[model samples]
Target: MSAFRARPPAIPTTLVDDAVTRIIRWDFEPGADTGVHTHGLGYVVVPMTDCHFLIEEGDSAREAFVAQGAAYRREAGATHNVVNAGSEPMSFIEIEYKQAL
Candidate 1:
């Protein structure tokens, strides 16, 4: 378990969890956060709505803007806290690829 404490936890809803992939829907209210964590598997994120994010890793932080219908992919083992930096709620579909068994 992580030693760091998470603020408001982001809500995650599982849509699929099969042999090769795991899909989840994440909903974040303004100022909510996904906590500090690492991605164990490579993942893709499809934005369900336009999103403004504050991504923090260690002491560094950056802002991101993703438009609705835009998608992005990340490699495994990336660690950071994802926060909703905008005034409204934001959501995205996250698909994590599982290695073949």
Candidate 2:
């Protein structure tokens, strides 16, 4: 956990969890956030709708714009907080690989 205290948790629903991978769907209303945390497994994210994000990493902050269906991957051990910066709701699917990819 980092020093960021941004609140109103984003909703995450596990879609699949197995020996090979773990999948989840995350939904966020405007201003909702995924609190600062570390990822133990490498994962890919596919945006379900166009997304506008405010990303906070330790002492830094940034913006991200991802189109719907655009998928991206991140390495394990990354720690950050993601906030829905757009006025509209947004959602994405997260697929975490159990085995290194």
Task: Tell me each candidate's TM-score.
Answer: 0.90, 0.90
In model 1, what are the clashing residue pairs, if there are any? none
TM-score of model 2 relative to the true fold?
Answer: 0.90
Please write out the lDDT profile of model 1 over residues 1-101, one tens digit for every residue: 56665456789999999998999999999888988889999999999999998999999999999999999999998899999999998999999988755
lDDT of 1: 0.91
The superposed Cα distance between candidate 2 and the true structure at residue 96, in angstroms, equals 0.3
- Cα-based RMSD of the predictions, in order? 2.8, 2.6
Candidate 2 lDDT, 1-101, residue by residue in tens: 57665567899999999888999999999999988789999999999999999999999999999999989998899899899999999999999999754
Question: Residue 46 lDDT in model 2?
Answer: 97
Worst window of 10 by summed lDDT in candidate 2: 1-10
lDDT of 1 at 3: 66
